[model samples]
Target: MDSTIRTAIAAADGDDPYRALRQLHHARIELTRELDRAEALAVRRARTAGASWQVIAMALEVSKQAVHKKYGRG
Candidate 1:
């Protein structure tokens, strides 16, 4: 999360607590989306780095073929 976002949330609370809470909720949702994207990128990169599909699948609790089906080629 960005420090600027935290500051904005803190300021929003000073004006209206409920609105600030809503703002925080929206921020959290966006943050979650961004984190998901980053995680996916990292997984792809790890696979490219020579990590085996079976290893990735085990960490993700899925089958090796399942991981390959989604990200095997690229």
Candidate 2:
């Protein structure tokens, strides 16, 4: 079990934990940004396809105002 813990905690690259941690965090940020872009594109497509703000909001599980506030101007 100790070996499992060690492996889980081990630096992915050499013994530089900081570099490994930074890489992981950067990857997460990049993925989040990519997802946001994809979501925005999807919203645009939906809007172009005659989907209402309320409908989009419901699909996104957010309020109409919230969805409009986020993407209406764009």
Candidate 3:
């Protein structure tokens, strides 16, 4: 994981384990959302660069249909 993320997690709610855990979970969810946004941007860029859905899907380790289903339309 990134050092900044680690630092943020470590700094959160040091007083209680349950609070720390909840903070960590929230941090993870935020990171997951960021990753999803980045992935969608990559897909959009690939499409704009003239890459086929099959190629993008294969690069992402998913089926072409899956990629299209997720990111094909505007």
Candidate 4:
């Protein structure tokens, strides 16, 4: 996996493991939220640049319908 994630897991496994685990969980949640925002921005930019949902879905390894449902305006 990612070196950063590995480091976090290692730190979480050290002394005071419970506190470390909570820290790791919080970090993961923040990272996930950031990723979601980034993805939404990327999808909007792609749409503005004339990319079709089918193309976006292919790149994301998901269905066009799924991509559209998640990122579509209406």
Which of the numbered candidates is closest to the native, going by highest TM-score? 4
Model 4 C-alpha lDDT per residue in residues 1-74, reported as the tens digit of each score: 25556667788768888877876887787778888998899998999999999999998899999999999978
Best candidate per lDDT, number?
3
Lowest-sum lDDT 10-residue window in model 4: 1-10
lDDT of 4 at 10: 80
**In model 4, which residue pairs have backbone atoms overlapping below 3 Å?**
none
**Cα error, candidate 2, residue 46 (Å):** 0.4
Worst ten in a row by lDDT for model 1: 4-13
Model 1 lDDT per residue over 1-74, tens place? 68646865796858788877777787888888898788679788887898888888888889999878876775
The 0-to-1 C-alpha lDDT of every candidate, in the order given, reads 0.79, 0.80, 0.86, 0.85
* Native-to-model Cα distance after best TM-score fit, residue 37 in candidate 3, in Å: 0.8
| lDDT comparison, 1 vs 2, better candidate | 2
**Runs off by more than 4 Å, candidate 2:** 1-14
Query: Per-prediction TM-score, please?
Result: 0.59, 0.73, 0.80, 0.82
Q: Candidate 1: give its CA RMSD in angstroms.
A: 3.6
Q: By TM-score, how accurate is candidate 2?
A: 0.73
**Candidates sorted on lDDT, descending:** 3, 4, 2, 1
* lDDT by residue for model 2 (1-74), tens: 34433444454655888876766666666667878999999999999999999999999999999999999985
**lDDT for residue 9 in candidate 3, whole number 0-100:** 81
Candidate with more favorable, higher TM-score: 1 or 3: 3
